[model samples]
Target chain A: MTTANPQTNETVETIHEETVETNHDDHGHHEQPPKGIMRWILTTNHKDIGTLYLWFSLTMFFIGGAMAMVIRAELFEPGLQLVEPHFFNQMTTVHGLIMVFGAVMPAFTGLANWLVPMMIGAPDMALPRMNNWSFWILPFAFLILLSSLFMEGGGPDFGWTFYAPLSTKYSGDSTALFVFAIHIMGISSIMGAINVIVTIFNLRAPGMTWMKMPLFVWTWLVTAFLLIAVMPVLAGAVTMVLTDKFFGTSFFDAAGGGDPVMFQHIFWFFGHPEVYIMILPAFGIVSAIIPAFSRKKLFGYSSMVYAVASIAILSFVVWAHHMFTTGMPKVALLFFMYCTMLIAVPTGVKVFNWVATMWKGSLSFEPPMLFAVAFVVLFTIGGFSGLMLAMTPADFQYHDTYFVVAHFHYVLVTGAIFSIMAAAYYWLPKWTGHMYSMTLAKWHFWCSVISVNVLFFPMHFLGLAGMPRRIPDYNIQFANVNEIVSIGGFAFGLSQLLFLALVIKCCRGGEKAPAKPWDGAEGLEWEIPSPAPYHSFTTPPEVK
Target chain B: MTASTQSNKKLITYLVLGCLGMFGFGFALVPLYDIMCDTLGINGKTATTAQAYDQQVINKSRTIRIEFMAHIQPGMKWDFGPTTNVLEVHPGELVKTAFVAKNNASKRMIAQAIPSISPGLGAKYFHKTECFCFQQQPVDGQSPADFPLVFFVDPQLPKDIHTLTLSYTLYDITEKTLGEALTGPQAQGVTP
Candidate 1:
């Protein structure tokens, strides 16, 4: 690798000498990355780690998507044809775990790793070594999680929420492994988040004041704070689950003065903010993309920052909305209900800002722009369903049904996951110094956009018609829609392979990209050369 | 050390402290949940304090049917049920009921019963004056134990709720109690 890249060696030596002359600091001892796989194993470079995280997330997305395929195949005809009920439960559970932790969260972290420093004109992450450790721990964490499936009793069959009595009193022998895996994932997220926070705060270029920083950086700052605050709470929750399962603790046992409902309270306390952690970065990505495609400055930039912070704060009190059917007192129900509805305000502000940014400008539908536009419309549909679910009395009818499943998949799959796809398309040129095949990317987008709706749209009707979620089979009344859904699911699964091929093609070779790939783009990242240098901003640039 | 490095260290310290503080807050929710439940009178959590039953005035104009339900948690080796499944009583009139529990295991076991009332709005109205669910019951091997519950429906119970289901789920607490006993020096007299 060193022989292949003499330019990188010269750049590193120049940075080292410059660092020595400017300040006697520890960073002056920079070394060349080793040849072969050792470069990845022992690398502390942010771009390398970001690549690792992205690849890991894509691999997990396929794994989780394959599990979704199994579910659709089983539900294809609504009979017990593909797998046993026990195995079906495991598929649903592990699929949720992998997608949320292994795919979406890591993908955002990957984007932050790559973009935050470049956007702020920093040398690297605040703690580059910790960044490597954070990325490395994730593979092992997911390995432990996936390995549990082949265990004697099979992996955790409880839903991803893993409510007690089911997870504690009646879970299989692999609950310990599941708990430990979750703990490690939490550690990884917390460390990654801490690095993002510190880098953004301490490493910004001279003139990149708080307001001048890119919206992505600002949103990630809030997101990192949320992660640092809540990931530890998740650690606490899974620890209690481990003890309740193996040790003689009764934290969730009713007979020993413990209430199972208390478990939901703790989990959702960590869980609700966690949902925002997955989405706020999407907001940042979409905010970045909408303007680039529309040739406009982001509408209401300061308000966007305030809206994200408010949403983060409001996330804490609205968790009980998930438990409206648990029979909380009328007053408590009203309080949570109102608080959940109050979240719509800031969210509305964000949606309006995106629309305002795109209103009547010279809009073009590149693959990234297409995904962002789809996100605005489809995510609003998800938001409307969420609003309906927030009403206490209405939730009594919708709880634990496919309606609930439809609501989340809309936000998660279409909202967060689509934003990730858009970010990849938008940044591929900058990272690879080549433009990806636009034709294949558009095919990937259109196939995904249509089939994904065909897959999840019927779930709303199924839920409204009283089909409960997490079940292996349903009554024959729901058979036809399930068939359509399964077909759509398979098509959607196949479309992602095109994305994989596009990425590989871009990385290998394509049309050489200019320094500024997008005509309307504006950022410090755009100011830098394509395939951003081995060490960025060794001498920080002035933003203004 | 440079000022930037010092400030970075301070920020990291505060963030690490915040993470620890949030972890503690998660555990704090345990007590906070109990306090919330007690104050809201939701989730069928009955009051621990015995109530004074008002026998002076009985609302004979209305009759409410009360149903009893019993469940055994998995891994609990005990046979338990309510002596009476259903009873009709006038509002404000105290009623008494009994449940029989027999240890099916070869070894002595301690069990605790958790009570829940359905149509959860009826929880505050259905006051328990004396209930076996308030304490743990330890039964020797193959012995049967009868525990009684004394409660009354307050006349103020909503007129719409004419029927209520009171269910008790029994769980084995032997291991936990044994651990506590061992630490308290009471295990010397007992054989495992």
Candidate 2:
């Protein structure tokens, strides 16, 4: 119910609280709740906020997953199975929105809230109250969005990108609400990111220098900066949409001295960075886990840091790759094409660093390692496809096709989601004070890996055959691929059930976990007791 | 903790003022937006800066469906309907066009087509919106996209900025604009 604030010379909690003395003058335990519902509502503690974020995102993940289920079922057949074409379009749009905003991103934030302070030997986040507000705003924002589906003309059917003219001229009456909701979501994200950047930059313990920080924290620092940079641009884009739709201004209208193509320019400028925002934390997670399971010091540790930084810098310029097929000038296209291709070198460095980290060092394929290994293999596959997509001429063929769909899913599902799964397994013992069932974890991983590939791999062929994306219905020529994709989707969806069961069962109780479960695990976090105390390192841990 | 003491009061003040400003702006935006779209809602009708007709036209690797309109007087029904379908011409072959224009109005109506690019961006590289092809063709029609736009000129047309709207209701080979119009006559004019 209360934040744990350490007293400094300038602002002393003890002096302030004693000045307005109550029955309990103790600052630490002052008027906290009766320990049940009150704990969550008025809580400013990092652990509490982290738990709330995790649970909220989990619930949203299921809701988003259900929407995906409806979409896959509809695409299960040649003709539409259950919903109207427009309704089907809404499902695809919402599913993506929920998954991106509501699921993958939030999960990482939750992990950050819990682990960052512990990892760096800080007592709490730099701005704990703002952290609470950031977590709280998301549910309401999503509520406003999901509720729009029932309004007069229905919710956003203009795809998740909300392209103009369609979003502006043809979109339904509820679009105003959509804009407002996005504005709120952007606010929440910006606040959360600012808090992360401040904490990572300023709040690390005395000896936890930049180089000494864990890979996960380093990547988050970069991701937070990316969020700060791009979320505003997204706001700018949506603001333009609002003006074009409602006001006389024509930022996107060609006749209004505006260019709809300009909207893409602005959008991908934000979006290309957004893709990395979702995955860089995953990179941090895999970097952490691979070394722990390999029983060795991370090979080329400093090189890994430099590689991540370089990749982040490179991400800013390569945004035009997404706009390659959007009728940009030829010279611009050539520039972006080469610039986009150039990202592979830095990305390659990280992959090489990871492989070298695990090279011939008493390697163990625990559940975390299984997911981390899957992340490397599948993410590389996604990366290879991304390189192919970077080619200007080939991009023309692949733009907005199922190939784009396959490409992003590999990155999002296997890259981001797999890392999350790995993080859960990697840190479950530490969090729950109990070991998770490894057999169940393995079952979850294998089923997911197999089904995910089954779901996404065929999309490449379909895309090559010119099956366009974001369409509710396909011609009979694509019937088989669609069917196979549907089955894969179903299997992937079902595989998640095993994961849910395993996580919940572990959280309840299991074999007792030790303080340092992995032989090679070396971090401020592992040095703490299993099931970390609510108030950890009130006095900063002396990092050696 | 040290950071909070310094930034906390400033942060709270900023958030409160920010919220008030946002609320005020949010309420004001709806009306402001409505006015802008109505007055300046780009219907894509603008004067064509300049043009050249390549009558000899040798670059016919592909055939394109095009829509064209001519202004006539209201109540003056055209004997022939709109000419808005594909006109197939051979590479380097000369092509010509004819459009019926009549005046059935009691007063004279003057009109001019704003500048435009044809085939749009849809033809080349397909930026879709950046093609810069929406022009307000001077037409005495109900609207440009309705086709065979049977209309009358406004006698009060100003000499300065005589803006007009011309929308070409493009239909795919299998699709017909007439059917689309019947579905629910969405106003089509200059595309913004």
Candidate 3:
């Protein structure tokens, strides 16, 4: 409450006044970040919206987790008990959609909105109003998607890929809603990406060079670019599906002279980069966490940045690898195979650099670092599976099977989602001005690590045994693996509740935190006071 | 250099690796592009109604009747999906069927369903079919992928262009792979 400098005091007062006017558009001239529940409904502040996105993402994570439980449950004994085949399919389809869009993506965006301006010493987002709108649109997108499940024919039973004829000729009425919902989500993503792009370009402090910015910021910059480019292609693919289903176009028809295979071509074009869109930022997050805890600069910093971008570029060329079994010619198979395998080169650099950063360093096993270490281990497992799948011949055995499911769940749930959980733990003190319950956080971490592996690993065995995906029921021979997979799924689902409890408990009230919670942490972000101000860096900080 | 300058240098060092990545993928493009085009069947002619259709396998066999007109190729001997058909044949092997495609813009357009009839499980190869006898002939006046109906004779002449009729009752071969091509596996996790 003490301001030694008149200029600093005056600037705060000015920021407060302008914020009040902005509040008129938000909570309508209310003081103090719009206190009541109404604040969430009527707040434009980047920090508030960022918080909203984080919470929403976590909630959806649970919902998606429960669906995964159903999958695991059904697999538990091999007999179809917990849910029906069609509904089981709905669970898989919605589970994939919700976790990817509703949870992980939003969680990262929340972190970015909270961190980017602080890291670069900017006042707020580049386009504040659009940021608010983007956050608001996601809930509606998911609602429409979820509601489609209970619809007469079941929600989007065509698998997340929504292959044509299957989607066009056989899909239920709710597909129209699914198409629209995806449309809105894409709009939200594109606008959100554009805002991030502009903020990074124009609003940095006077001397924060691009190279000087943190790795998290750099990876997100690339991530945002990937978003802008591919979100549109998703929109295009879905639009073609829309017309083909209802409007009578033949974009994916083999009979009307259109090749159904073209559908995979278009979908994966958006899809491949999208997976990178999820992981690139995680690469950035782990890069930040490892260094802060290790008391060392990131190993091979330039190499890390280059590796992240390289992965992004390569994402586009590997799209057709997903379509290898759908009747493609021989040469295209090899090309995708080779291009896909080559992607591992840059990815390998990233993994090596993470380990090298930890080598011989004074590493502390803090909660964030614990999760990061788990991420490196498990995500690597996922990555290795990906490499295996990349072998064109090997993929024949893996594609559309639980093995494919197992691979992505590791990369996504452990790789990306784990990083987001780590980011929350690392920054909670800074955001809440109070240290969270560490005992609870460590509980959440250990539980998630053990449970997540249990949840995803057994599927690999089943998949290798030739169990296909997207089917509601399986033959009885697969009972043992299904049972183990289901038990693992429930354990993983329950573990996430601890994360929610820790986060909520911190937000309510806790022991006061010092501004720089970690001594080794370095960034413009750490320089700011704990519970980062409604507006940090009203005047930008110097780079050095 | 100060630590800051050194760190900045390290960042730049890695960025060059990114450029290497670009070139790396750029190298894979040509061969990958060729593979993508070929496997996707982008180069093969789109199977037209006239191109003789292949026959299907009858497992739990039941007679399913299918009625559609196709432009029969003159020289190519093709079979429909199933086996029962009576062609109104003329002396010159005169090919007869509906060639004009009615564009019903108001409702769904019904393209001619070229029928394919062959042997049951472990039956003879789907070498030819009655309905598939229709071939995609790029007639002098027709549009893209359009083929005129053509029929040939063994030293027999009936080229009057009329009264030649081919008819066949198609059996159901649905849910069966008409045939498996040499395409490899479906690549998983291509999504970014």
Q: Provide the lDDT at B21 for model 3.
A: 48
Please identify model 2 stretches exceeding 4 Å from their true place: A1-34, B1-139, B142-192
**How many backbone collisions does model 1 have?**
0
Model 1 agreement with the true structure over A1-544: per-residue lDDT tens digits = 2342554344444443443443233334444344688778776778888989999999999999999999999999977998999999999999999999999999999999999989998777877778989999999999999999998999999999999979998899899999999999999999999999998987876667999988889889999999988999889888998888888687998877788989998999999999999999999999999999999999999999999999999998999898888777687899999999999999999999999999988899999999999999999999999999999989999999999999999999999999999999999999999999999999999999999999999999999999999999999999999999899999999999999999999999999988889898889998888877767777767555
Across the candidates, what are chain A's individual TM-scores? Answer: 0.95, 0.94, 0.95
**Best candidate, TM-score:** 1
* Candidate 2, residue A133: lDDT: 90
Every model's DockQ, to 2 decimals?
Answer: 0.47, 0.06, 0.04
lDDT of model 1 at position A411: 97
**B-chain TM-score, every candidate?**
0.82, 0.30, 0.25
For every model shown, what is its TM-score relative to the native structure? 0.91, 0.78, 0.77
Task: Name the candidate that leads on lDDT.
Answer: 1
lDDT of 1 by residue, B1-192 (tens): 545566678998999999999999989988887887676667777776678876688999999999999999877788999999999999989999888888999987878888888877788889888888877677788888887889999998988899989999998878878766434543221222
Every model: iRMSD: 3.8, 9.6, 12.9
Candidates ranked, most accurate by TM-score first: 1, 2, 3
- Residues A145-201, candidate 3: write the lDDT tens digits: 999887788898777888776788778889999999998888887767766777787
Q: What is the lDDT of residue A43 in candidate 3?
A: 62
